[model samples]
Target chain A: MDVQAFKQRILPVQGRLFRVAQLFLRNREEAEDALQDVMLRLWSNRQQLETYQSLEALAVQMTRNLCLDKLKAHSRQKMATDGDFPEVQATTATPYQQVEAADSNELIHRLMEELPDQQRFILHLRDVEEYSFEEIEQLTGLSVNNIRVILSRARQRLRDSYTKANDYEADY
Target chain B: MKPTIEKLLEKYYDGETTLDEEKELRAYFQQENIPAHLQSHAPQFRYFANARSEHPSLKSINALANRLNAPEPNWVVRMGSWSVRLAASIGLLILGFGGGLVYNQLRPSAGKGTDLSFISETAPEKSLKQTLAFEQLAKTSASERIDAINQSYEITQADQEITQLLLNTLNFDSNVNVRLAACQALARFEREPSVRDGLIQSLKVQTDPNVQITLIDVLVTIKERRAVEEMQRLAENQEALDAVRLKAEEGVQSLNQAGNAPS
Candidate 1:
C-alpha cells in the first residue's frame, strides 16, 4: 500500500490501539509510545496489510503483543532492582471512608485496577470495545469458549465487589 | 420488566447474552431510577460506557503519520558529492580567516574594548538555547517538549520570551504531564510579575484537575492575593472535581489568612 492508503487504513485505528496499550501498560506516556511503535510497524508492513480481513483486529493484536513485551521488560527491570515480583494488592477500604472520598466512577476504576491483566483486557474488549466473540477470538487467539469463560469470571468478580462496596451504603 | 431484566442479568453473568441483550442491560442501567437490587451493577455498566470515550489525541497521530511518510533523503548521491562540498568549505574558511586578519589590522582600536565582544559572544549562546527550546516546544511528542522546558532552566537570565512560552505551554499543551512540567518550571520565575499574573489567569482556564490543583498550589506558594478570588470561584464551581474544589477552598482560606497577617 502507498502512504495515503497506509494513513487511511492504519491511522484511524490508533485510538483503539492506544487504549489497548493503556489497558496493559497502565500509563498514558508509555501507551502513546507503544501506539507510535505499533503504527511504525504497521507502516513498514503496509504492503501486506490488504491481505488481512480486518485492519483493526491486526492493529489491536499488534498493540497487545507490544504492550505485553513492554510489561515483561519493565517487570524484569523491577525484579532485578527490587529482588521481588510486584504483587497486585487488593486495596480494601471501608464503605464510609470511600463514600465522600471518591465518586462511584473512581471507585469502579480502583476496582478495575485490581483485576488480573487477562480478565481486564478481555472485559474491556468485550464490553467497552464491543467486539463480538469471534472478533475477540481473532484478536486474542483464544477459543470463543475460553473467551466467554474468562469474560464470565471477570463480570461476576466485578459485580461481587461492586455490590459488596455499595450494599453497605444502601443500608444507610 | 424487572423479571426480564433479571433473566438477562443471569444470561449476562453466564456470558450467554448476545450483544443486543448486553446493550439493553447497559441502557437500562443508564436510567436515573434503577431498581434497588440492580443498583450495584450500574457502576460497571457506566464504566464501560465511559471507557468508550477514552481516546488518544488525533493531532499527535497525524504528526506521526506525516513524519513516517516524509521521504528519506538520498544519502548515496549526497556521499558522491561530498568531496566537492568539503573543498568548498575549506576554501571559505581560509578566505574568512584572511578577511578577519585584514579587518583586525585596519581597526586596531577595536581590540581595546574586550567587554563588547564578551557581551556579543555570550548573548547568542543564551538566545540559541532559547531558540532551540522554543522550536522543541512545537514538536508533537510530550517528552521532547518536557526536555525543552528542562533546558529553559539553563537560560540564566529572566527572559520575557521564555516566560511567555512557558505560560503558553502551561495553559494550552494537550498533554497533562507536559503542562504539569511547565507549571513547575514557571514556579522558578515566580518573582516576575508577568509569571505571577499568567499563573493566576491560568487557574481560570485549566480544566484538568491535576493541572488545576498544581496551579493552585503554585499560586499559594507565590502568595498571589488576586488568585484567592479565582480559587473561590473554582471552589464554588459545581462542575469542578471534588478534590480540586477542596484544594481551592483550602487555598482561599490560607491566602486570606496570609493577607490578614503582618509580615
Candidate 2:
C-alpha cells in the first residue's frame, strides 16, 4: 500500500496487534515492542494484506506469527521479559492442590504450561478463539481430523489434571 | 452411550463432530471422574483463544511511530561540521605562518645568505659616484680607504673595518697583482697609529713568511721605527720557526740600519 493508505488503514489494528503480542509476551513493554514490530511488518507487506480474503484472520495470524518470532527472539536474547513486571512461576505443587487453591484461575493458566505446545495451542484456537477445525488446520497445517483428535485428546488431558483428587466436584 | 477416551479420539480424528460432540469433549475433560493418572495434563486445553486481546494506548503508538520515522535536518548540519574542520585547518595554517614571521623578525640575518642575495638584486641600483668612489678607494692608499670606508658603510660594522678587510684580502688574494695592490694600499696605514697596531699583530701571529717579508719591506719603506722592538722580540722567541725566525731577524736588522743611516 502507498504510505498514506498504509498509515490510514493499518494504524487501527495497533490495538489488536498489541493484544496479540501481550498474549504471547505477557508484559506491557514487550507488548508495545511486539505491536510496533508487527505494525512495521504489516506496513511493509500491506499489499499482501489487501489480497487476503479475511482481514481479521490474516491480521490475527500476522500478529501471532510476529508474536511467536518475538518470543523466539526474546529467548535468543537470554532473558525472558514475560515476567519482568512481576509474575510467579508455577510453584512446587501437584495439579490437584493448585486447582483446589483460591487461585484456580492462575492454576488453570499454569496448566497451559505443562501441555505439549501444539496440544495447548490447538485447544486455545478451538475453545478460546472458536476457530473452526478448518481454520485451525489452515493455521497449523494439520488436517481437520487431526485438529479434532488433538483437541479431543487435549481436553481429556485437561479434565484429568483439574478434576478434584477425591472424585468430588464441590467447592474446595 | 459414548465410547470411552479411545472412541472419542477416533471420532475426533475422523472429523465427525457436532457442537455437542465438541462440548462433550470439553465436558469429558472437565468432569470429576477423570482418573488420577490423566488429571495432571487437563488444563492444557483451557481454550486460551481469547488471550491475545490486550493493547497499548493510541498515544504511545503514535509517539513510537513518530520516533521510528524521524528524518534528520537538512544539509546545513552536515556542511556545517565540514565547515568547522575547514576553518580549523585554515586557522592553524595562518597561526603557523604568523609564528614563522615573528621568529624570522627576532633572529639575526647572517651576511652571506640567500636573503642578502635577494636584497641586493631587488634593491635600487647604486649611484655612479658611489660605485666609482668605492672602486677608487678599493684601489687607493689605506689612509684614503679609511677616509672613504664609512661614507657608505651600512653593510659592515667592525671597528677599524678598513684595516681588517685590507689585511684579510692581502693574505688570501689569489692574484699576485691583487696581493701587491693590497700591500701597497696598506703601506700608508703602516704609519697610522691604528694600522701600526694591526701590522704588529700580523707580524706576531701570521705564519706566512712571504707576507711577513713583505710587511717588513713596507715597515722599512714607511720607516715605522716603532715596530723594530716588536720585530726584535719575534726574532729572539724560541717558538718562532726557522724560516720565520730568520725573516724576523732580517726585518729587525733592516730597521736598525734604517734607524742608524744618515738622512
Candidate 3:
C-alpha cells in the first residue's frame, strides 16, 4: 500500500497494537520491534490488506502471533541459559511479604506479567484498550461468553493480587 | 455517583459491565474524590487509564510510513544511470584493497575482466565469514573495517551472505563512514526482500547523522512510501541533526505526495 493509504488505514491503530504487544512481550523494546515487524508485514501484504474483515483485528492477530513467537523464543533462550535451574515463580513471595512491599505498582506489574497469555491479552484489550466485547470476540476468535469468562478470571487474579499486597500492609 | 460507581465496579469485576458502563466507572475513578470504601479499587482503574495513555513511539510510526512508502527499487534504471561511475569507484576501491590473492580467489576466471557480477556468485559461506570478520573488527575501529566493506561492496552482489554482512555493518559498525557506505551498498540491493528488510531495520538502530541521512535519502529516492513514518520520526527527534531532520521532513512531504498521487 501507498504511504497515505497505510497511514490512514494502519497507523491509527498502532498504539493499541503496541500495547497488546507490550502485554505479551513485557519489554518495550521487544514490543516496539514486534510492532515494526508487524507493520512491515502488513505493508508488504498491503495488496491483500483490504480484503481482511477488519484491519484492526488483523493487526491485533498479527501482534499476538509475533508476541507469542517472541515469548517462545525467549523461553527457549532462558532454558538454554538457565539449564538445570527451576524457573522462578512470581508468587514465591509470601502473601505477607508481598503486602509489606511498599510499591503496589510494582506488585501489580509483576502480577499482570505473570498472568496467563490469553487472560492478559483479554484484560489488555478490554480494560486498557476499552474494546467492546464484540470487537474482542472478533479479534480473539473466541465467543463473547468465553472472553467474558477469561476476562473475569483475569480481573479476579488482579484483584486478588492487589488485595494480597494491600492486606499485608493493613495487618502490619 | 458513588452508588452507581460501586455497582458498575462490581459488574466490572464480573466482566459484566458494558463498555459504556466500564468507561463510566473509569471516569469516576479518575475523579479526585472517592469514598474511602471504594478507593481500594482505584489502582486497578488508574492502571487501565495509564495503559490507555501509553502510545507507540511516533518514531516507529514514522519509520513504518517510510518503509511502506518507498518505491520498489528499479535495478535497471539505477544500474544504467550509474554503472560507469560505480565501476570506476569499484576499480579504485579494489586497488585500495591491494588486488591480492583474495581478488584472485574472487575472480576464478581470469579472462572475464573486472565485472563484479562474479562476486555475487561466490560461495555464500565465504560472505558469512566476511560478516563474522566484520563483527570482530567492530570492536577495534569501524574505520579499519570501512576499507574491507568498500572492497566487499565492489565484489558482492545482493546475495544473502553479503546482505547479512552489510546489515550487520549498517547496524553495528561504529564508524559513520562504514555505515554510510553500507547503506549505499544495501540501497543497490533494495529489490531483494532480505535487503529491503535490512535497510528498514537499520533505520531503527542507526544513530549517526550521516548514516541516517544517507539511509533516508536512499529510501526517499527509491520512493519507499513506508519511509514516511521514519522520516516523520527523524523530523520529530529533537536531538537529531537539524539538517537531517529538515531533510526527513521534506522527504515526508514529497513521499506523501508521490504516494497519494494517481498511480
Candidate 1, A52-154: lDDT as tens digits? 9999998999999998998888673211111110111113545563342245666676677678988999999988888899999998899999999999999
Instruction: List, residue by residue over B139-225, the lDDT tens digit for candidate 1.
Output: 447776777777767667767877888898888888899899989989999999999999999998899999999999999998899
lDDT value, residue B180 of candidate 1: 96
lDDT of each model, Cα atoms only? 0.79, 0.59, 0.75
User: What is the per-residue lDDT of model 3 for residues B202-258, given as tens digits with 9 covering 90 to 100?
Assistant: 777788878888888888877788778878988999999998899889888888988
Candidate 3 i-RMS = 5.2
Give the docking tier of candidate 3.
acceptable
Report, to 2 decimal places, the DockQ of model 3: 0.23
Better of 1 and 3 by TM-score: 3
Would candidate 2 be rated incorrect, acceptable, medium or high by CAPRI criteria?
incorrect
TM-scores, all candidates, are 0.50, 0.39, 0.51
TM-score of model 3 (CA atoms): 0.51
Count clashes in each candidate, considering only residues at least 3 apart in sequence or on different chains. 0, 11, 25
TM-score computed on alpha carbons, candidate 2: 0.39
TM-score, second chain, candidate 1: 0.52
